[model samples]
Target: MYSSIELENVEPRELEEEAPTLLSVGRELKPEKMRPNVWHYERGEENAYHRQGEQEELYVVLEGTVDVTIERDDERDVITLSKHDVLVVPPESWRQLRAVEESRVLAVGAPNVPDDGMLEE
Candidate 1:
């Protein structure tokens, strides 16, 4: 049986050493309710790198504003999201985002296993 569901103050961690950065929170710390190898990510930055692969992805804006670009099935679209806005991308789609203003975005997906995601390069 699970002991607790409370992950008190689930603070973001740093890179390499977990210095309290957002990547850590996004990369690690999967809640019990989520899928195994789930990807729960939060970006508090001005820009994000582009990536694509076999898994699908969803993005949720927490504050401010951001723009997401997606490519799939020979179609391309740019989506702008404000606080509380959400966007979903299908598997095999390429995507990237840019912060129009200081922003926080939550990105979630499944099978975030190492081999499921890829970079264009």
Candidate 2:
């Protein structure tokens, strides 16, 4: 789904040192129930898998492209997303993002509160 201009004003933060190199433009729009925050992850030499607890996400590709594997419904699906591509992740979905090319994205969802629910280690 497309985001409304009013609701899309949220900006994404760059999370390099910890992640990779990329631009994220919607750092705020996280859901109330999940604790919302946004950040962008760039492509690294290595790939990683990640998931958030009980919360869903809408990742809209704002620049470049990336290869992704989304694990859901007891299965794994691979897809390549590029500019303007929007991906919706259902609750409890497991996902891995690998930069097939370079990529930039917008992560909009809850911040994953309760501390234990976020993808941070």
Worst 10-residue stretch by lDDT in candidate 1?
33-42
Query: Considering every candidate listed, which one attains the maximal lDDT?
Result: 2
Q: Report every candidate's CA lDDT.
A: 0.56, 0.58
**Cand. 1 Cα-lDDT:** 0.56
lDDT of 2 by residue, 1-121 (tens): 3332343454433343445532232323333454333334445422346676755777777777877788876898999888899888865777867665556566555555453334526
Where in model 2 is the C-alpha error above 4 Å? 1-17, 21-47, 111-121
